[model samples]
Target: MRTAVVFPGLMVCVALLAGCTATAPSRVRVDQAEGGLPNCKTFAWIPTPQQPATLTEQRVKTEVLAKLKEKGYSEAEKADCRVTYVLDVHERPKNKPSVGVGAGGGSGGIGGGIGVSLPIGKRNEQAGTFTIDIVDAAKNAQVWSGSLDATFAKAELNEDEAREIVAKVLERYPDRAPN
Candidate 1:
């Protein structure tokens, strides 16, 4: 029937679209202290040891600040909570197998041969982990932490992309300041 043919074509189109729009794989994890998040609404950035000094760091910082503001938190010199972020990037080991095809013919006869493929080289892809931590200023201990691990084809990220990553991680945070 016409409906059956069209349905299969539409399904194929949908599958192709999905493949085209695939996003990088990412995982998010959150940890909280025994007492849970403090009811503090203000935050200050504490220096992270060996933090990467790069343009990407600046972009991430900007996005984090924006997200915090959106969550009704403000920055202050003497805030009740302190915050910090770390970005780490490294190359992932390649584990993909190669693919191949073979065809052959002989004069006055038919012949066939089998071939196996072995990968010669691989493209190096980098994976990055972004982590944000909140600490209670009075107690000087961590209150809550969120971490995102993502595989990337490139190292640089624009503002919107950076915002997307930060937003995904911060989505786990309370909708409003914790009480």
Candidate 2:
């Protein structure tokens, strides 16, 4: 009984103390960079609140670089073509989506307080922000750049998940290059 009662507190504790980072698409929709190439691609990423611009950032960068290299955009610009990508990461605060429940049979006299909500529905109020960014690596300026948001689950990231998500987001990159 006591453990059950402590569940809510624990949930709240995790929600408030533990950092929840969800990765979404990109942010920058427009590009201001000058110069154009048909085959060059550049990239830079900004870290999220949970993960700052550090070693973890390098991991993310390396992933992007690998993908770009694989796509054959690493030397796109050198060939006097068009290709460039500017990326960044950022985060914001969000209310935990949650649900609620309450058992009342007879009368009541100010049951709970404001913050103390008795969930009557599913827990859909787990508040947490996301870590995402915008990737622009199109022809002239921005041929591809979008935002991304994700939730935090693993302290150490799994490469498979990272690649899949990044690939999914890039799938929607603007088509300035030859189709």
* Among all candidates shown, the one with the greatest TM-score: 1
Instruction: Please provide, for model 1 over 1-179, each residue's C-alpha lDDT reduced to its tens digit, 9 standing for 90 to 100.
Output: 11211245545655675576556666789999988788878888886568666777788888888898899898898998888887687887544543333333445443333455565677777778888888999999998999999766667766776888889989898856455
TM-score of each: 0.67, 0.37
Q: In model 2, which regions exceed 4 Å deviation?
A: 1-53, 75-143, 154-161, 174-179
Q: How do the residues 82-132 of candidate 2 rate in per-residue lDDT, one tens digit apiece? A: 322233333333344444433222243323322343435433312222223
Overall lDDT per candidate, in order of appearance: 0.76, 0.41
In model 2, what is the error at residue 63, expressed in angstroms? 1.1
- Model 1 misses residue 134 by how many Å? 0.9
- Candidate 1 local accuracy as lDDT? 0.76
Supply candidate 1's per-residue lDDT for 148: 93
